[model samples]
Target: MLIPLVLLTALAVFRTAGALGVRRFDGWRVSAAHAMAVMLLFTAGAHFAPPSVTVMPNSADLTAMVPPQIPFPELVVYGTGVLELAGAAGLVLPATRRAAAVCLALLFALMFPANAYAALNGVELAGDAPSPLVPRALEQVLYIATVTWVAWPARTRPHPAAPGRDADRATGAGRRS
Candidate 1:
């Protein structure tokens, strides 16, 4: 929950900055891509991070957040971790950004059930209780919406150094014998 909030806040800042003339992040899609990439990477690291003495749990502790109805909760946690990491990596590339965003949005939607179970049944992580149900649900909704927005394509812009541009020319890759 905290992570998602941070990501959303970061997105807001990026958007505001872009509006104020930060051309690099001038588009919502680009901002979303950057936000999701960073956020997902941060969360993904938890899957392999060392155990802590806080409310937040280690990767294995994620099983506790999953409802009992779901078999192999731990595996789900690991799978989600890999998915998030892959999504983050894919989000950076212009060719795969949209597909990755859509997939990540779907992943977020599917994750709501686990979050709901956590709230309804008092799911805890390393002694850390989940946020209230209403807020958790609301956050999940907003998260999914934000992820969906990331699927929107940024306007195309060829890099300054492309195959026939600066870098490729210097590297001679664009020059055919």
Candidate 2:
């Protein structure tokens, strides 16, 4: 929990700084995108920590708690970690950003079930109990909103021939004049 919160704080700070720098210094979209990608990578990496046997019992315990459920918890955890890393890498490059954003949105959705389980079952963390389900649900909703905002497309480059394209249109560039 602390790890994720710390990573999220860093991401917010870097995002703000990047937005300010890009707006003021100009021509910084690629740099900003890269910074965002790195932040996400760190955030995603935090999730791979071995499950808390104390808080979240082992697979056997989980089965006891909620029996007849999916059996491969380790696989789920590692697979999610790998996807997150890949998505973070994809977001850093301009050519793959859009695809990365879509993947990240899916990832967020995919993780919701685990979050729900933790909240519903009162899964404890290192020192504290699980958060209230309502707040936990709201937090997930906020995460989804953030992902959506980050994924929204914006024009990164000024159009060439800004003035001349209008003139060309008046002179019937698209038609016989």
The runs of at least 3 residues in candidate 1 whose Cα sits more than 4 Å from the true structure, single-residue gaps closed, are 12-23, 52-55, 153-177
Task: In model 1, state the lDDT of residue 68.
Answer: 86
Q: Give candidate 1's whole-model lDDT.
A: 0.79
| lDDT of the candidates, in the order given | 0.79, 0.59
Candidate 2, TM-score vs. the true structure? 0.63
Can you list the residue pairs that collide in candidate 1?
A: none
lDDT of 2 by residue, 1-177 (tens): 443475466566665666677442233344444545665666555445444544433433322222126566666656666887887788666678777778877877777767677768876554467667777667666655555555665656756555576767876675664
The per-prediction CA RMSD against the true structure, in angstroms, equals 9.2, 5.9
Tens-digit lDDT string for candidate 1 (9-116): 778988898999998689888888778788888777766655663545677566777878889887888899999999998887878877887888889889888878
Say which candidate scores most in lDDT: 1
